[model samples]
Target chain A: DAGVTQSPTHLIKTRGQHVTLRCSPISGHKSVSWYQQVLGQGPQFIFQYYEKEERGRGNFPDRFSARQFPNYSSELNVNALLLGDSALYLCASSLRLGGSSYNEQFFGPGTRLTVL
Target chain B: LAKTTQPISMDSYEGQEVNITCSHNNIATNDYITWYQQFPSQGPRFIIQGYKTKVTNEVASLFIPADRKSSTLSLPRVSLSDTAVYYCLVGEPLPNSGGYQKVTFGTGTKLQVIP
Candidate 1:
């Protein structure tokens, strides 16, 4: 089975520009989450969507947002990109939301965003 | 979310066993400990998760003591491919905590498996 997949494998944007990254979850998965990984650090949670509803959010700024689609796909939007926004954006999918062991999330290769 | 603390890095050789420990002194009752491994440019891959005691899988073993204040991830006979960053995450999902449950990952332990 195909794992979670992300689009626009690499992107370059300038300050003040907006960018949207896409992700398609593994078939039958119903939850998607986003994270940002800067160089030499662990991924930081951004947002999580389950069953087409916003289930959770992280300490990200208001400029970051995400939503899950009917097909279980998700989109992460970052507005007014800052130099600090230049990091790898990751998308992960789980069979469902919550603490079930079966709900383990599988992540994608991620989209490398470079803010110029 | 329970904050975790792990070594910044570790070194091991082929055919050697490597154990990385994480401390979460303030872990909540509902929080479960999960570990993830990540290669360069790729997202983290789930390694193993455990609530308490010992949990073993084909890849590694997770050992949690009764106190639940700390856990250890043991990799047996690690190879060069096992060189990656290992993260320890602690949290529960769902309607609790303002319905915004999320895992906060700290700087992971970078394991370098030398040939």
Candidate 2:
């Protein structure tokens, strides 16, 4: 089975613009989470959705938002983007919302966003 | 969430064992220790996870002491392809009432495997 998949492998936008990144979780997965990774840093949690509802959010500002669909696909939106927003946005999928069995997350290739 | 501290980088020759240690002095009782490996320009991949003692999988081994304040990830006979940034994360397995599993990752240790 295919692992998590992300769309628009690369994106470039100007400051103050808006951008949307997409992710399709693995088949049979029920949870999707978003993360941001800046250069030379580890991935930081952004938002997590399970069962089409927002489950968790990170320390990001109000400009960042995300939603999950019934099919377990997710979309991450960033408005009024800034140069600091330039980074790789990763999507991960898990079996459920914090399932007790390990809850291992499988990540996708990620969408590299460059804010000019 | 607990804060983790790890080395910035490490270097080792091929076919050698590489050990990365992470310190989480404030780790909670319900928090589990997990490790992830990320290559440049790619997303992180889960390596191993354990609550206490030692847990070994086909790819790596995670050792957590009785105090649970620190953990070590051991990779046996690592190859050049194993070179990557290893992140140590501490978090609870269960989600909060809002249904979000809060996880925190550290700066991670970048491993350089020389052939």
Candidate 3:
């Protein structure tokens, strides 16, 4: 099966603008998650959605939001983008196993966002 | 959520076995240990995960002690392609949902495989 896929391979926006990143999970997958990885640092969790409901959120600010579609696809939106928002936005999909603490996620190449 | 600490970097020679250790001293009973590997400009890929004892896959092995305070990721026979950042993540279950939460991916261990 194909791996997790993300869109807008690269994007450039000015400060205070808004950006939306899209992702398509693998077939039969019901869970999707987002992460932000700044240069020279590990990826930070943003949000996760399963069964079309918001499941978990990280330490991100209110400006960030996400939603999962009926088909299991997901979109991540960041409002009032700051220069600090510049990073690689990654999308990962996984088959959730009940009663387990962790899900093995397959990630996409990521959408590189640059704010000037 | 439990925080994890790993080495900033490591150097390994090709064809040699490499082991990366992660410390989660504040781990809880519900926390499960996981590992991921990532290369430049790419998203992280799951390597292995385990709650306790030993878990091995075709790609690597995860060894967690009885205390569950720490875990080690063992990669058999180093190769040039194995050079990447290895992350040790402790997954915490959300209170409302059964899904796990990703709090932070600590400064991972950068492994540089040498020829």
DockQ of all candidates, in order?
A: 0.60, 0.67, 0.61
Considering lDDT, where higher is better, how would the candidates rank from best to worst? 2, 1, 3
For DockQ, the strongest prediction is: 2
In the range B34-97, model 1's lDDT, one tens digit per residue, is 9999999999999999999999999999999999999999999999999999999987645534
lDDT for each residue of candidate 2 in A8-92, tens digit (9 for 90 to 100): 9999999999999999999999999999999988899999899998988889999999998888899999999999999999999
True contacts kept of each: 0.66, 0.71, 0.69
Q: Rank order by DockQ, top first? A: 2, 3, 1
| Tens-digit per-residue lDDT, A1-116, candidate 3 | 79999999999999999999999999998989899999999998899888988877888999999999999999999999999999999999988634546667889999999999
lDDT of 3 by residue, B1-115 (tens): 5899999999999999999999999998877888999999999988888999999999999999999989999999999999999999987765554655564689999999999
In model 2, residue pairs whose N, Cα or C atoms come closer than 3 Å (at least 3 residues apart or on different chains), thus clashing, are none
Q: Which stretches of model 3 miss by more than 4 angstroms?
A: B94-100
Question: Worst ten-residue run, lDDT, model 1 chain A?
Answer: A95-104
